[model samples]
Target: MATKKTSSKEAHHATLDGEDEDATHALELLAGKIGEPPRSSLQAILAGTTDADLVSVGKTILSSRIVTDAARIYRKAWDFYQEASDEQRKRLRGFSKPLLAVAVQQALALEQLDRKLAAKSTSAGVARAAHEKAAEAAQSRAIELRDQAYDALRDAAGRDEGLRAQVDAAFGTATTSETLARGLEQTAKLLRAWLGSDDEALTARLGLANLDDSYAKELATAAKDVRNAAANATNRPADGKVTQGALDRADGINVLIMGQILRAFEGAHGIDPTIPRLVPISTRRLFNRKTKKKAGEIQPPQNGNGPQPTGDGETLSDG
Candidate 1:
């Protein structure tokens, strides 16, 4: 008969069983505190890691869990610690540093990375909407100012017979020129010509109408913004999936914590059956929804400006 294979995970726990039970029990009693940690430490941690860092050292291990999975695993471990009595907490202090702290740091980093990626994914849409809104408002304002200038021209025509010829020459005798009277481009051209005209009367009429090149400039800016937004949207680098770099970092973090846990139990004895496998390896099994895969995926945000999670929102700092 072929001998049964003992998986690395099974072997790991089996090794844990050989460690000093008192140390394992002490570490198990109190968990790390929950909530967002300070930002400086987090920035250093985030910048300190990369995809290249998750290399295996001869021993193979599986670490495919997503960012949220890591966060929740830390949360669960912290939840267990939160239940400890003052005495149990004091017992935990005996160890120079509780092993779980290593896991918690990565949990926080993953939460931050998740948010950054989620924001990046939809940034293009947000910019497009903002630019479009500005363009719409600018066109409306330009048209309003154009109508005001037309009224100024009409009133000036009634007052000055000499100006009437210029008006007819520029616009028309009875009605304004359709080419010069319609659209944003037309309004801008009319404003520029009248504002910059060498004719003293034309310049005076513009002053009387309170029309200036400022409105034309605003329209120009809005038009440029729309074009820029469109280009940026096309070039944006996000696809609503966890970035490969982020996934690799997740693997690195898990491996770090797992090594710490394994070392913490080395040479000790007796199985503490209560120790959770800590986290799943890339499976969405953390929630135990078990109904179907992909159920945990989050819907895209309704608003362009605010950020939402890439995955399940059950964890607020969800990855």
Candidate 2:
């Protein structure tokens, strides 16, 4: 019998490129042969394989045009995600700064409300005291009037016929005086009641207290929100080494502190034309003084005399 002939490499290559189905079959067969997947079996086959060089073939496939296109697309998508995340962080920081400011303002407002309530309470007390004093004065005046009216009525009761008409007038005056006294007493009672009324006092106090409480709650909520935002910002991965948002916040804080300091200095200085303006003065200069002392002296008389001089030609001096 004739010896069987094996297929040549070039014959296999031609068969592999003949049709789509044939190419796929050829690739699957090569994959089993080399234990690796093929890239475009038809192209590989047209190149004509001589040995099972799957490693070199795979490296070439990866460096080819198709993989390069896929890598470019992936890089574009990753950059877009990074940009979006950066924008989101910036927005969060922007919102957080104003929210923190609002929280501080709310706390200040609550303090102001407390002061106002205290002032109102003080005013109420002063008013009540004034009312009491007025009521007392009215009561004393009423008592005096009543006593005078009684005296007049008694005197008129002893008068003659024509004077009897005047006595009736005195009786009317006495009645008016008693009515005035009753009115004054009632006013005093009303004032005392007003000052001691628990309901009214409680209502006023509660109104102010409620306002303060509400403001405190708002401040607390805003502070919590600010803290949460700060935490999130810190926890999130930053795109750059330096955070711009943090720097902006630090600048804002510095400005605010400077403004407050200026305002405080202005307030401390009284407004007077003769008063010196605010200036930095050295402590040493503020306390420094110069002085002279006399140990002995020769005196000159008021009379115009040609001088009396020392024998040594030294003038008498004070030291």
Candidate 3:
């Protein structure tokens, strides 16, 4: 039998078809295209494995001011159009006037919040109530616009079955991109809180708060270095613009931060622990003793009571 090598395109398609590793890679690629914070946040949300995860993810999505603003715009337009007489709606330009109206509403709501905020002086209580009401309405509109977008995309997909996957991927990318961006911002806030206080009870419990001043400063400095390096690395030109040394430096800092994030995550409870691993290129390398260090050194088994390797690379049985 001949061994068949899968092409990169085929592998990517496989991810859409449900291969775990490839799907994860596809998501990572999607995040990269979407940009940082959102990408990591999106990955974390996707990796969520419990009810608590869902709740955290939900809050992240709901609290996105951008999404809320977009929703409000669509809702305001929809509401205005709904109140219009049939003749008035007909007077609006375009064949798909209704759809155009919905899209315009999305754009319009960008300024809606500002206008509402500016109304604060006339009557504080009334302004607050109106603001809340507007947010609720906007949220509803956003949902409606979302449904409309889905319907349009799906309807087109039905006509061209071959494009279904593309359509679905596009829709998924857009929705997840927004959610991920919002989640990333939230995650940043959480990180700042964690690193802000040396006497924090949680840090104390984790035995991190007791670290000597020098060690703590070193850890903090390493984090800052990693962050700066990452920003530079990601912004590098695709046409071989950045030097190899710069890339290597970024890689080194990444390894440093990975350790810090994992250590912190293992001790915390409020956020998803595995979210750190979602950072772009944040992969753990398994120890390959055969290739590095000694050729004959024994390695301990991670699980099961299987025969262990002895010194000089021979297998030994304890039983």
Candidate 4:
């Protein structure tokens, strides 16, 4: 008589029963707080991690300030959605999927929060758009990873009865990758903000000992000349020196420093600089540099000329 062999399915089930029970209890606790779908998705990820990695991610989800921040944003979006007029909601939906009103509301919240935080730091060189873009990229990647995990769980569930409940919990009604991704992205942004350093501070730490070369002197002289030229240019300089053509030809560096640097140049001659000086330019050339680099390959410097020790810091404003 031939005996039936214990199949792989049987083996998996036999081993997973205890594991599944533990996972289920953990899922219940997380689901109560953050919803079952994302919690299940988190479980899927945690299942593949070692004890150390699992502990780390668990702390991030549970203890990070950004997680609370994201939750607040989500609550605000939900409230806004509930209060919105039907016609406005309909118009918003026409703009995009996954409920446009919620999307825009959350986006605006994220942008405002990013700006507010960056403003508190010596991050004058860091653009608000840069942080927003970083968060968006993080969200996109997190969503992609979560969907992949869900799909794998679904395929496994097709063959194993034990995994079917997990699949259901992850992909059941009202569960969307977009929601999970937003939370994941907010955590990422907060992590990035904490890890980021101010470039000017770093430079000051490194010291200017290497900047005593003739090239440095020449560069400083050139910058001063350009500043003066930009400050005095009605069309061209009276000394027949080459002034910047128009706003269209000037780069971001030129625009930021031309008027202010020119003011400092006058201060050298005992002329006190005033606020709200104007630069003459008909066209403005904005920074639109593009590259083929991957995200995280390069990061923008997080530094700028903050208030000097003598409290003589200049504030540049648009007219």
How far off is residue 61 in model 4, in Å?
48
Q: For model 2, what is the alpha-carbon lDDT of residue 94? A: 17
* lDDT for each candidate structure: 0.42, 0.30, 0.31, 0.30
lDDT of 3 at 304: 46
Using TM-score as the measure, the top candidate is 1
Candidate 2 lDDT over 1-319, as tens digits, reads: 1121121111222332233233234333332333322334324322432122221111111111111222222233223323544433343221222222332332222223323333444555576666555545544555554444334333423434443453333333214324443433333333233234465543354344342333323323333433344344334333332222222222222222222222222232333222112221111111112212111111233375322211222221210
- Top lDDT model: 1
lDDT digits (tens) for residues 1-319 of candidate 4:
1121121112222333454344334333333433323224323422433333222111211111212222333343344445655643443322212222232223233223323333333232243445445545544544554454445434433455544454445432213334453333333332233224364432332233221233233333333433333333323213212211111111121222222222222232232222112222211111111222211011122374211111111111121
Q: Least lDDT summed over 10 consecutive residues: which range in candidate 3?
A: 278-287
Return whichever of 2 and 4 wins on TM-score. 2
Clashing pairs in 2: none
Give the per-residue Cα lDDT of candidate 3 at 128: 52
Model 2 stretches astray by more than 4 angstroms: 1-95, 156-178, 181-319
Q: Candidate 4, 296: how far from true, in Å?
A: 54
Model 3, clash count?
5
Pairs that collide, model 3: 38-180, 38-181, 73-105, 73-109, 74-105
Clash number for every model?
A: 8, 0, 5, 2
Q: Against the hidden reference, what TM-scores do the models get? A: 0.35, 0.24, 0.17, 0.18
| Clashing residue pairs for model 4 | 247-283, 248-283
Between 1 and 2, whose TM-score is larger? 1
lDDT, candidate 1, at 110: 44
